[model samples]
Target: MQTLEKPKPKYTGKRHRLSKPELLAPAGNLEKLKFAIHYGADAVYIGGQHYGLRSNADNFSFEEMREGVEFAKKYGAKVFVATNIYAHNEDIEGIEDYLRNLEEVGISAIIVADPIIIETAKRVAPKLEVHLSTQQSTVNWQAVKFWKEEGLPRVVLGRETSLEEIAEIKKHVDIEIETFIHGAMCSSYSGRCVLSNHFTDRDSNRGGCCQSCRWKYDLFEDARPAEAWISEEEARESSVLKNFKLGVTQLPLFNEDDNAFSMSSKDLCMLESIPELIEVGIDSFKIEGRMKSIHYVATVVNVYRQAIDSYMADPENYVLKPEWIEEINKAANRPLNTGFFFNTPDHEDHIYEPEEKAVPYDFAGLVLEYDEETGTAVIQQRNYFKPGQEIEFFGPDGTFFKQTVGQIWDEDGNELDAARHPLQRIRMKVDKPVRYFDMMRKRK
Candidate 1:
């Protein structure tokens, strides 16, 4: 019998000479910061103890920020500190000292919205790069040019900007243009709205937003011939009055029976448009979610890193992987849409009946160590996991595989039915091998 000739693998060459844009991820705390870097973030943006948005997040203390910077440097990544709050007179006080401290701690850059803070940073740490924050409402090319003239090294453009507008702005400005590629979007224009302050006395600009825009509203019309104009307090007091006496119109802006989430915009997902984004010359791709979980940070950063790497490796044969989208959806997220990238998003982009998309998997545990001799993996429980349940493992090397949980034992060698407690350490026999820091997720 004659042997058939072996077939050779097809070769595809590079399609473009484009440089990969920085994959910028959010770091709510030290753990998330490390995960972001390990999962392949080129840089991580974090909030300091004061002046940054996401006031509820565990913003880094000065010492933590110092340590975070050193940790990032070990992986050849940078740390950008957020000082982007719109400052009041009280907020401006001691800002210079804060900038000096940041510079001393070896921060890669400072994100600033207030002109005063920018001027202060320039004066205090002239060597540090200043990134104009998205809170600056940088939409037009003229505004970008103005910011460039003011000596900012980069300007994060408003989310309202279209791809064409971004390309135009890039042409007019010499500085870098960073745009938010993923995460939750603000209802207001470039997040410059007073609804939070108006409703709850929590200043959105000062990082005290209550997200009042996302709340349900009842729109009532006064039928009393324009003479029934009353103070908001008086109207509230008289809200119980009959429709005839109150001159209340019958029609509602939304269906009265339904509580519509009219103002809630869907979370941005630019995975499918990565090629277009690259073609437009965007300098940095930002992921928003400082208050998000560590799993979110790891998953999002990992997927985006894969997309960027895949495209960079062979742009000619680059294809958006279905698994990337599946992985991103596994994280807690709103309904996904491409926000203002292809065109201006209209009513279709807003979820009238807001419902979170269910994730296909649940974070079950994390691999702490593996004992080769016993074929047992030491793990820490993140969520409840029991023996006989199937789990999927994903690691830094991008390997993913499924295996069934076997016999489990606690640290003291006591057998446990389930690893139910958060951060509870357990040991389990595994047929498939896993390394340290590997994550296990159970199918829902």
Candidate 2:
């Protein structure tokens, strides 16, 4: 028999981006879920305490899961529960029960990675939508078609795919492709590396990643060791390894700089390239932080919501404000890059720095009741709202109103220095009408 080669697909640019695809964001816990809804996520994805990739983050309990779903529902935002981690046989034993409960609670979707779990979801919660998690490393049209045939309602495309590749896949496939448009990027492809597991027994897939890949190391050669790794310089200079590290120890053949393939890039940031993504036909855009605080959630969500709207409104004159970028940076973030969207994957994306020191910003309160006619807002601060500092009030329609703090009054109309307790309701005057779920923040 004669062999024949498979034809390479040509880029004819037939398919284009959706006019208005869903904006999906990650919610590690109940509060962030609220933030996601408030700031303008069309849908939010959360993980139960088990069977998710982010295990160590403050994940939701079953009770919290119910509340999270309800919270998202109130604002017309969908909630997708993640059960997307790779599982062993034992992990599958009680899977049906979990699926049943999630389905019963009206979860919008159940994201899964393992084919077994997908099967389980289909069999147990046939009514529930199944989204294929990116952990599956789905890159090509064949794999995309196979999963769609297997009954996945959507697929969270791998972070490693370039914009052009994504558009190419969209042309060939009819199924929806969800992609991580912003937020963090894994140093490795689709976050399927064992560096964290190998070094610290904390598997990232299992949700216990210690992030040893982001740790500083020294290069060693037969007892001789280089003190530190310059990731930028190394990435630009070396072809053998794009990401080089300093070896913490010296051994006969253990050269951390040369031998360590564990070097992954820093996380990805693609806020500026959103228009490019929209032009590329992405069905859904995902923000990648569940471990982050509610403030982080609110800021990123608000910025993206505005950006998406701005682009949709008038892409010809669409200009992202410098303030939006600054707002994103206020959250805990690595050095930013466009990821593999524009150029090839480079080692420069890796976080060579030590731990990120966050400039403190916390969600202080939300307007529970607002009387626009009276111009008075009744808010419940999540934390103590110390008076006298200027605070930002993020309203429902993406209008950020800043007001100088004045006399804080209790329900009795008596003034106080600060709302010094969690869930403390305080009265404040607003220049304009504030709606329910509108966020008020005090940056420390």
lDDT by candidate, in order shown: 0.85, 0.77
Candidate 1 C-alpha lDDT tens digits along 330-399: 8846888999988888888887675655556777888999989988999999999998999888876476
Lowest lDDT sum, 10 consecutive residues, model 2, at 8-17
Q: How close is candidate 2 to the true structure, as a TM-score?
A: 0.82
Off by over 4 Å in 2: 1-17, 222-264, 371-375
lDDT value for model 1: 0.85
Candidate 2, residues 1-444, lDDT tens digits: the string is 865974322223533333777899889888888878878999999988679888678888888988887888788989998888889778879899999998888898988888898898888899889999888888888899999888787898877788888878888888888988777666666657887778778767777777666665655454322322445565445444322434323444444445344464656678887777777778798888888877778788888888888877776677878877877776645667787778876666565445466546767888889886778889887877766777888754567788877777888998889898788789988777788888887777
Error of 1 at 9 (Å): 24
lDDT at 311 for candidate 1? 77
lDDT of 2: 0.77
